[model samples]
Target: MLKGLVIVCANGCFSSMTEANSKVKALLAGRKARQCCELLVLESALGKGGAPWDFQRGSDFSNVDPFAFIVLA
Candidate 1:
């Protein structure tokens, strides 16, 4: 069973978070309580090892883009 939804944004931007949150909420509208899951947002630096997964060398997130997030359920 899904208990939560996590949004991991590459850059910590308020606008990005807000947009993602709204999208998630819209998607969950009209769902039953049990079907709906808690939402969480996390800020990370993808090229700086902020994420647990490994990335290839030379990857650049120097200028992190807006609204770049990974959804985990």
Candidate 2:
């Protein structure tokens, strides 16, 4: 299932992480050299204005990093 999804995304049905990362890297590289860093926002398919995941709350989140948020709206 994961392989199928990745293949679809790679075929342009959706944007994959590799594409997003490259785009972000290029954008940041062009910014002012003096700046330490900058932020680049990308829409997520899982939690960005979408249904919640199977394990999105309470103890389920305990096994996951706080920064690794699902895109549930």
Model 1 clash pairs are none
**lDDT value, candidate 2, whole model:** 0.39
Give candidate 2 regions above 4 Å deviation: 1-14, 31-35, 38-73
| lDDT top scorer | 1
Candidate 2 clashes between residue pairs 3 or more apart in a chain or in different chains: 47-71, 47-72, 48-71
- lDDT (C-alpha) at residue 28 in model 2: 53
Candidates in order have lDDT scores of 0.57, 0.39
lDDT of 2 by residue, 1-73 (tens): 1111111111232355556556556645743531654444333333333334455553575544323422211
lDDT of 1 by residue, 26-64 (tens): 766775843767878765544333534335422556644
Q: Can you give the TM-score per candidate against the true fold?
A: 0.42, 0.30
User: Poorest 10 consecutive residues of model 2 by lDDT?
Assistant: 1-10
